[model samples]
Target: MATNAEIAGRFEEFADLLEADDVEYKPRAYRRAAEHVRGHPRPIADYVDDGDREAIEDIDGVGEAIADKIVEYVETGEIEELEELRAELPIDIADITRIEGVGPKTAGKLYRELGIETLDDLEEAAEAGEVQEVKGFGPKTEQNILENLEFAREVGQRQLLGEARPLADDVLAFLESVEAVERCEVAGSIRRWQETIGDVDVLVATEDGEAVIDAFRGWDSVDDEIESGPEKASVRVGEIRVDLRVVVPEEFGSALQYFTGSKDHNVSLRNYAIDRGMKLNEYGAFDVSNVEDEVAGQRVGERVAGETEAGMYEALGLEWIPPELRTDRGEIEAAANGELPDLLTREDVRGDLHSHTEWSDGNNTIEEMVDGAAAMGYDYYAVADHAEGPGIVGGMGLSDTEILEQVEQIREVDAASDIAVFAGIEANVDAEGEIDLSDEVIDALDVIVASTHSALDQDAETATDRLVRAIENPAIDVLGHPSGRLLNERSGLDFDATALGRAAAEHDTALEVNSNPRRLDLWGSAVQAAVEAGAPIAINTDAHQPSTLEYMRWGVHTARRGWAEADDVINTWELEKIREFLH
Candidate 1:
């Protein structure tokens, strides 16, 4: 059955569509309730069944009217108001507006004016040059629509992080190999681990900016040149757009600082620089109309962004800000108070907590997984592929009998291997929050990672309650990817993290920071919140193949955003301590 969380999530999507369509206030109300319901601790249907709609009334922005609608939807499997709204619009609003620049209002307008209800219709109209005749849309806007429609049709969506990170590494390696380039770093959303990336931004510092630009355009992956300039160059590599920005060696630090931005962070920093009678840009900050009259914005003077990132901070009379903490979260305030938690580093990670093998869907076997971990210098590794249940598509997970048999093989590997091997299972959490594996089997494993694999459409209350129950289970060692979101592919589940984090802490269950670039689960803010609630984190690669084990760098970056320290992570502990944690 569709749980309360699932229903609420659908409503939330409808609400976003309504907002895009510039629907009435009720759409916003539904969205607000969806957010609140998704975050509520109790199962929403409890209140609905009890004839007390007030169950979620206390949810911020969810008043009596919205709660009653939720109750009505739960009982009858239909929300009257939503049905009415759909009757009026009755369009696949999300599909039409998913194009880069198209919003809900535009989608609605397009639908109403020209009956354009799908990407196909929009593309046909754009190609026919009929869209330029729309009320407010000009030829330029029509051109943009045509361009984006073609791009969207060809590329579908931004490349997944799993696919993009290795490409980033390859480019970085190539840039480093260039003798003229002094330093280089990835900047923008890819660095931020945003669910989707529009383009890949790379900032390079070189003695010869022109030579670096030429080299970038000549990159082996470059299939076509989009633009070539002294400081910046854009190229099309297959379908992905790679943008390279080159700066002089003297200005490298400033360029890095300017480029490695959360836009808002850079804006705030630039304002701070302006206040200090300086101008900050790709070129180093300069004293413009300064009291001391040093490096003016117009006339470049001396480099001040280097010496250390801290020096950049010293110039602004602020403490150094870590790249991950630059999200305009509490970093500025935390830096001011000198209260930032020392974030975890790759060195602090002693082992990988989650891996897979040929026994399940993984390409590598236990021995191969162990050797891969050992090569990466990990002291211990866990082989926790799918355990019999929902997530094991095509009936691939290990059955209870098979799991017991696998335990012996795992023991054999552990006994023979130099590094400690943890026998574990990635058990599925059913819609009701119950794990598929028996307690006897769960207890036998060194680690039990309970994950949600099916019925992803549950309401927030049901999803949260389901998860809360799973976390409370003593047999379940960690709640893997608490949100169950799969980047651009899927939004796994919606639940109250505050409640889940509390339950996890109460049960002493770790929350996984899944290191798979495609699924950096328990993302930055959630990790921070979980850490604050005293829930230890497990940075697991969930590696299906040997090559994937190295994706931990992106996972570490994700954790650092939460200001997670080595002490806050379970994998940072020694094998003995990790065993104690499991027990």
Candidate 2:
């Protein structure tokens, strides 16, 4: 049976192809239906299998035409119209449009004009100066396509943190069930909470390495065994690659520290150890000061520290740094000076400032979302659903009158609820940096999250200026998803974070770290720059459903990776303090 993701992917491709074929309204309808399908709480396939076409059509933005296609796909595993369209185009539309400045229209144009059907063909055309010769495309455009080709090739290899972390948890649970395994942890970029991860790395401490390896290979989730040895193994679990390594209980701490590395951090620590006549590796930290043989291997000299990560760091006269802080971005120096930040944790988050309800492009009601927040023990919650604007489709954004009506409903819900509920709007920031809603409507809300939903391909300077203008708006409390990037799919904007951060700080505006797995926007580096510029951060889930509220963990870790302390995030403040800031 097809999952919602698979079905939504088909609809999205259908939309892209239709738009490329120059079809107008139908493409928007398909795209909107695709978005709604992707976010629907229940399995769309289940509805189809039950022979309920009305249930499928009842989904927001899905019409009868789309419903028929859904039934055809679920029953036959194919859609005749989509296949016909694919046969007609006969090009890799997705691959071609993934280039930075290229869209479906441009891809279609290039294919029609130059018979370009693949990235290789496009690259060939660009290299031969044929692209510049095409009407409506200049030499600079050709150069840009060439420049971004490498990035396009590297785009979809990594999995999002939200997708990878759960798989890691499952593997950990399996390993923990083994009696030989004394300790187990997931390391590498996942441990650092990078938005995208290449693979899941698991480290284990056990008396019997062979037993652990055998158990891992025999696990039910293993799809294919890539390689196996007495102490290590690599296997494919579902769509992700899982790498496992086992060490003795004595070296577990050192092994964990070594494997939970950003390569640069390991290099820096190794050099620091060399300077102090010590050796550090996966085995343990050792004192090589009195050793006669300089070329001696891993366990060659006196073992100075091997029991704990803190011991390893202490051997080098430094404090233990958090894994998220181990990116070699001055973390070693900070540790040496006892200045490592008291980073923000999941518990520090008091409320989410950007979230949605069924009022606009969400899966639940205002009361359901409020209950979800209260269940999470939040002191306050903000319902900041989409407001009517450009780039918002299928009537998903609320109108001015609708905004006022929703605010009244929010008040009624709050009156009966234990947790404080603040009504807000995720106002669209237009290309010129103006909010879409009227001033009267903006003033009526308790929280205002201004975000850019369109015009993402502006030049860096223009993008920076646009965000600066939005930050300068007194009514805007937060700058949502500063770059507007969607991990592995679109590079949303190019802007100067320093400029935007400085402007936001001056205007008392908070920059949001949007915690939706796909859009961990205002990513760690940007967060670091913004925080350094004296701008406060707000780690929001931007969640469309109640279950997604748990994504707050990803946001909090992303903030920690940015060196943000609890005091640096506005949402970590008490309700009165947050209210005061809003005023």
Top candidate (TM-score): 1
TM-score of each: 0.76, 0.74
Model 1: per-residue Cα lDDT over 1-583, one tens digit each: 3454566776776785677567688676676566546534445666666667555676555787777767777778887877776776766766666565577788888888888877889989988888889999978778777766766666655687667766777889999999888888888777766545777889887778888888888888897676678779988777777889986666667767777776656766777777776667766666664345443344454445653446676776777788777766567667767787788899899998788899888998888889999899989989998988876687779899889889999999999998998899998988888987776787678888888888887766778899999999888888887767777677777666667778888888888988887788877767777777887888988898888898788788888877799988999998788889994
| Stretches > 4 Å off in candidate 2 | 1-156, 292-294
| lDDT tens readout by residue for model 2, 1-583 | 6655567888988988888888887877787778667545455776776888888888867888899888889888999999999987867888888775688888888888999999999999999999999899999889879976876776645789999999999999999999889999999999988888978999999999999999999999998776789889988786677999999989988998899997668878999998998999999999998888646677988898877878899999999999988866678999999999989888988999999999998899999998998888899999999998877889999999999999999999999999899989999999999987787787789999999999987755677789999999999999999878787788677666677778889999999999999998877767887888999899999989999998898899988988999999999999999999983
Q: Ten residues in a row with the worst lDDT in model 1?
A: 290-299
Residue 218 Cα positional deviation in candidate 1, in Å, after optimal superposition: 2.0
Clashes of 1: 11
